[model samples]
Target: MVVAVLLGSVRSDRVGERVAKWVIAELESRGHEAVLVDPMTLKLPLLDRMWKEVKNEKGSEHAELKAKLQPLAELYQRADGFAIVTAEYNHSAPPALVNLIDYFLEEYFYRPSAIVCYSATPFGGVRAAVQLRSLLAEVGMGSIPTLQPVPAAGDALSAEGVPLTQQLAEKSGKFFDEFEWYMRALAAERKRGTPTGTAA
Candidate 1:
């Protein structure tokens, strides 16, 4: 199975990269294909009127957004599941992730997604996870109920851009287990032409 990781932090602290790499490694160790989807690596604007124009005007190009979209959507179409690792900004996920998720609708449908949220404060932006789960379901993605939240996150992060506790390592295993259950179930339900719960 292929698992695509959507990393949410844009900080140079490398929190997103670190978490993505580790998660991909863990997934790979278990014989699954895990990939990191870094928003930073792609040339995307924070807010571009281009995307707004393209969707409205016939034959207009979403050149800026398409660079990221075409590639990601292709990968997304083939993936079995996804892991979105993001740091909260002002009690919510980064705007980058919000936009990224919004760019595509149907490509993410009928797939499993899990969240790994972190923040400087307590609860590790678990509240955002709730809202994020809502959004994922709205976009036709099945969200895994089990999630990882690293609280007091700044204290646990070192200067070299590493997590101090690595608590997410353990949670990832459980997340993957649930993903397997949900992915298999969703595939079966699709074939059976029956709908299941929005959240798994």
Candidate 2:
């Protein structure tokens, strides 16, 4: 399956990149295509209007925005699932991740999302993951029950996303297995048929 790994943090010295890199590598190792959607590089503007709303507006001003967003729309639409790597901010999910996801709705329909939350503390960004469940579900990529939390992310993985400990690698194996199962299952179901309101 083609999975988009949405990196949630854009902070200058953020550790989320390391976590996301590891996730991408894992997905690839499992024979899945992984696309890294880093918010810093994506540089999507703060959501004033969704892509669905913007695409229908007729004007030169909207044309430029449409050109910029067209590739992203294609990528999201083609993805079979998403793995959202998020950080905690004041006991909630980061705004950058939310803004990146809010740009499109139908692109996410009938897909599964996996929450991989991380934090500097041992608590492991569980709060942010909890908050994301509702948002992801509303967007139509309902999250799986398993939440992969990377505690003390910097220490857990190297800057290049190589796991420093056997425990982390082992845990990730189980997480990826569950995520892949959902991805395949949902992809099959989507092929069979989606609900009446599903996207074409």
Candidate 3:
């Protein structure tokens, strides 16, 4: 399955990048296509209008923005599932992640999402994952039941996102297993028939 790994943090010294690297590596190791959707690199303008709204506008600025977003929209449309990597800020998911995801609606319908939460603290940003579950459901990619939370994210994985400890390496199996199951099930269903508001 092709899983878009949405890297949620864009801070200058963000550790979430390392966490995202681990998530991507894990997905690839499981034989899934891992596409990194970094908010920092995407540089999407804040949510004045959603992708669909801008897609219909005719002004020069809107045209340019549509060009920028069109490929991303197609990417989301083709993706089998999503891995949402996030950090907690004030006990909520990061704004960059929310903004990037909020730009598309139908592209996400019927696809599954896996919440991979991490933090510098021992709590592991699970608070952010809690909020993300609801947000992801609203966008139509409801999260899988098993959440993969990396506590003390900096120490859990190396700078390159290689697992430093045996425990961290072993913990990922079930998470990916469940994610793949849902991805395949929902994808097959979608192929049989498109959901309302989603493009086939």
Candidate 4:
């Protein structure tokens, strides 16, 4: 299955990178494709006054951002499911993510998406997860009931750093189980919509 993994923050020093890396490994082990979409590495100009008005047409002020958004749109459409890893900055979804979300709609429709939020408290950025869930639903993406909120965000990672008491394998096993279901259910739905063999 193609699972587009979005590290949904533009910050250079994001804490969720570890989580994303971990998820990628789990997904890959199950013979799935996990593509990373890092907003920091992909730059685009301000999108307020231009893209909305011109709407991806030629010579628009935000033509660059509009053009850049196509790949994201394409990826969203191509994937069977998605896993979004994001950071919380004051109990809200990051503006960069919000704006990019505004750039498209139906591309992400009718798919299952799992959310992972990390922060310093039990809230575990759950506040931001709530906001994101609503936003994603508005665009027609169904959120899986399962969520991973890693409190003390930076505390539970193991890519070469001092590992935690809980074995990484255990945590990954649970996460992957849900992801596998999400991918299968959503992919079945998508496949049903596709035509087979010669047109009837």
- Model 2 gets an lDDT of 0.90
Off by over 4 Å in 4: 49-56, 59-63, 158-168, 194-200
TM-score pick, better of 3 and 4: 3
Mind giving the per-residue lDDT tens digits that candidate 3 earns over 32-67? 889898989878888898888889777797876788
Taking the tens digit of each residue's C-alpha lDDT, what string does model 2 give over 20-110?
9999999999899999988898777898988999887888877766887788789888898999999999989999999999988989998
RMSD of each: 4.4, 1.5, 1.5, 4.1
**How do the predictions measure up, each by TM-score?**
0.78, 0.95, 0.95, 0.81
Pitting candidate 1 against candidate 3, the one with the higher TM-score is 3
Query: What is the descending lDDT order?
Result: 2, 3, 4, 1
Global fold similarity of model 1 (TM-score): 0.78
Q: Write the per-residue lDDT of candidate 4 for residues 141-186, one digit (tens) a residue.
A: 6678777776676677765323363744466467668868877876
- TM for candidate 3 is 0.95
Task: Report every candidate's CA lDDT.
Answer: 0.71, 0.90, 0.89, 0.72
Off by over 4 Å in 1: 46-60, 152-172, 191-200
RMSD of 4: 4.1
lDDT of 4: 0.72
